[model samples]
Target: MLRKTESSIIFIQQLGRGLRKHADKEFVTIIDFIGNYKNNYLIPIALSGDKSLNKDTIRRMMKDTSYINGVSTINFEEIAREQIYKSITNNNLTELRKLKEAYHELKNRMGHRPTMHDFITNESIDPIVIVKPHKCYYQFLKRINEDISELTSYEQQVLTMLSLEILDGKRIHEIILLELLFQNDQVAYDDYVTTLEQLNCRTDSNTLSSVIRVMDLTFFVAAQRKNYGDTPICNLKDGAFHLNDDIRRSFDTNETFKDMFLMSYYVQRKKQEPMIVALH
Candidate 1:
């Protein structure tokens, strides 16, 4: 039998086959793709891509519960190709042809594989989970998602970003912002303004508004606009958001930021689904 990770990759390949066909046909060359993965679900994102496939659209599409499940990423194209070819070589020719067509569609839509930066940002990872033989991997993943629904999209984004920062030790805003922007270099004042608008945050200026919303009183001290000559400028709390002892300490010590929310999400999920274990 394939490993859990391999099964996840296969499932993603299947889903990508369907999505890639309808996706816009263009090579979205980006500095990075801010992909988020939880359990088996991999949300591959292209920041500032075609307007229709922008961040907001991707977020909304992912909110659809159906597509949110059984998603994963395979970062190695050759590995993906090898897997596909090996599977097809021994399978029925008709099914092989169909799989090939879908594989081509995915290749055309998403290009090759994701970069190393992509894995770090979204916390897309392979963490081992202990389970009984009867308990399928997808079932375990679904349970994990069910345990974390109280988290808003903004909150989830913040958590994932924080997770990455913590994993990387320390990260800069310009670097983070650029990673978030991914494919686009020409960021304007409006980009900041729009992110704030989506989150319904209030602030004195566009410069610090989006930053304020992202930090959400959980991790940052402040984001403020200051004048730099004739142009508007903003400073993020410190030089950059540090993920060393201070930040990690906060997550461990603070209730509102981590433990309380996690407990609530987990407890409520368990209470509502008492028979889930038996069902599994």
Candidate 2:
């Protein structure tokens, strides 16, 4: 098959036409001559029928097809595999057009506006990709002209900080402390370390201090600080960390802002649970 089609569905349909069984045919030889196309990465996505938009899964399917349910084989030349890898790396999965398409498709499937949690639960495109282009999911909805509640300038900046930095689940210390503060209004450093220990996370002094810095925006570079409006999510005083007064006020007064922040936190916590289990 000529690898000229940009649509994965069309590519898969073309491949399907040749896979029909014949009276005398034992098997069919399907040859795909890949070209230097930007969407060559979609070939594996089509063959594997994986809609996760996960590059690693695509790469794994290229490497091994033995786990496939049917008695079929997929072979890729080393050079061709490398070409697909390059395409996956260089292609912007978070481009506006792609994000909009994914959003609408998933929205249609659910018969309603899909939340970030809905995407995660459905194993659809990575919600991070949605946030990358617009800094938060609501902003992306806004860009697509979805009628949603508007966010204030301050609320928008706070969401940007959470989406860009905290919600990636690189480390859960900040999230844990933030959740604690939300529950109790303050968290002692000792209590924070104890909580990390209970979760099997690194409780080293440096790691603890780093979490504090991250929450207070001290860990970010000047440019990043400016992007987040130089706002601190937490404030430390008397050896206890408290949510920043302005932020806490926003959360207490604005139900919409509170809901968005808590939803992001819940998603991050869910993402970290697997790592926490493995640590034990």
Candidate 3:
């Protein structure tokens, strides 16, 4: 018989492999296999990021659910107890106390059932390139001098502006412009034009579209566009132009790079969000 920890780890490794096989993308998330949460017993972990319990972890403890869709019935209580046990076994005294305190601190917080993290463990692919581009990235933007550097002055400005706007994922051109001004709101075309002028980039919608098109053609960026609201939005992919601190650090440190690389790859895979194309 396998030890509980060993059993749970095996389950996790299995699920990890399953996710990799199921999804075209390398990174995996709870959302991919969450069609039937309660029956599947993957709900809590998907919702919460608690490290204690997760679907695979629970699966190991219970080994009951049929990984089939259209199941006829389920013994919810039995699985629920398995989830509760995992939560109890996984945590230390301090966390247990916190869980209990949180239970009473807010009435119905537990919702007559085990909490989210109690049922599932929250796992994520770590970041790839860890870059603190704010300083060096922006310094390249501060000076407008044209001839004395590696990246052209134009490229530097655009890259800095892009870094400042997006924290985790990519956005379309209009969305990027909108963020620079209204930040998640609508901005008059005039204000947007002024901002672009100040940056030495053209404000015309057509020119901006061309810039994106050219970048994609050159492999300087990879983007996927989708419709959002009444407008189209574009998002960047984990391609060459994108720079991440975690990824950069991994490459710099010979010893830690492999592990960090996997983690960063995971982060990039997880962060992909749906976006609309930029319509000129």
- lDDT of each residue in 92-190, candidate 3, tens digit only: 422334333433333244344222222221232111111222212223223322122243333333333333323233433333342442222234445
What value of lDDT does candidate 1 attain over all alpha carbons? 0.32
Ranking by lDDT: 2, 3, 1
Q: Give all candidates' CA lDDT scores.
A: 0.32, 0.81, 0.34
TM-scores for every candidate against the unseen true structure = 0.18, 0.86, 0.21
Return the lDDT, model 1, position 47: 13
The order by descending TM-score is: 2, 3, 1
Model 1 lDDT tens row, 110-140: 5653222322232332111101110222222
Candidate 2 lands at a TM-score of 0.86
Instruction: Give the distance in Å from residue 124's predicted Cα in candidate 3 to where it truly belongs.
Output: 6.4
Looking at candidate 2, the ten consecutive residues that score lowest on lDDT are: 49-58
TM-score, structure 3 vs. true? 0.21
Top candidate when judged by lDDT against the true structure: 2
Tens digit of per-residue lDDT, candidate 2, span 1-280: 8757888988878988898778998898898888656788998888776776756667787778665577788788888888888999888777788778888888999999887878888778877777877988778888999988778887888888888887775888878887898888888878888888998999887887788788889999999888876888888889888887887888767877887887777778887889888986
Q: Is candidate 2 or candidate 3 better by TM-score?
A: 2
